[model samples]
Target: MAAQRMRDRWKTTLADSPYGVRTIEAIRPVLDQWVDRRHGLLTYRLVQLLSGHGSFGHYLHKVARRETSPSCHECGDADDTAQHTLEVCNRWNAQRHTLVATIGGDFSLPSVVANMLSGEESWEAVVFFCEEVISHKEAAERAREDTVDANPLRCRRRGRRRTQFAARLIP
Candidate 1:
């Protein structure tokens, strides 16, 4: 009966929330082990991690709901979830693809999340991958902004063009 309840709750949670669905699906293999009574203790830890309502889980929830904009730092298009960050953000596709290739293919959100949660991959590796992608995206955006800022006409100076150019170059 308890097992049935867990399963029912899982299904209902998934149906009710995209974030919940993603989290649960990402951790499904570990969750499935709970169905066997022998793994009850490990399962309890999984549940705590899944339903803890702490910052870790809440981050995912926020991302999925678009409450926090996961916009591509490159193109500035909204990409508000793990899946979008991993697979669909066109601005970061080349970097993302390269990173995933290094990690091995079939690198969907669930798989990455699973690896992260399960400790199959080192935390350093995960952190490095995320930081690199975000940094690359941010650098792209900064480059775009710098290009716009550096254009002489866009600076809008009241002085002569040569003076403005010289003044701008001085800084």
Candidate 2:
């Protein structure tokens, strides 16, 4: 019950975000209740993460500002938004292809993920996709950290890797 209320508050908060009102309304109904199911606990967790509410780069960039740009460091193109992570990022092309085969026909990420999770059918595939994304992203972030650690002088020369600013939240 507390989780559901938190999710609800999240929806309300998102409704006021830039261009989020309509999308949040559409996704609101499918928010998971996190009850026990036959499948593993991990799938449900991944589902929650991908539901545009998790700590993905999109969430961090927009809601937290830990990222310098909301644009994906992976593809270095489109904004590092939730839809982009699930649908557009080139780094996840193979995983996205596999998920398309499983989920079929261009379903909205939030709705389909929520349903598949609650039903526990094909939920594993969704989990696999999310896992692959996390693995690849972590690897890339680590590579970046290594480069910065090795060449701190070079990084500092270009005025790169500045400390991130915190985003403001309403009381």
Each prediction's number of clashing residue pairs: 0, 1
Model 2, C-alpha of 95: deviation from truth (Å): 0.9
Off by over 4 Å in 2: 1-37, 43-48, 51-56, 149-171
Worst 10 residues of 1 by lDDT: 52-61
TM-score of each: 0.39, 0.58
TM-score of 2: 0.58
Q: For residues 1-171, what per-residue lDDT tens digits would candidate 2 score against the true structure?
A: 897697778767776777644355545555444343456456543653445654356665677554555667878764776677777777788888888777764646556545555555567777777777776665665565468444342132332333232233333
- Worst-scoring 10-residue span by lDDT in model 2: 153-162
Instruction: Please list the residue runs of candidate 1 whose C-alpha ends up more than 4 Å from where it truly belongs after superposition.
Output: 1-19, 31-73, 76-79, 115-123, 135-171
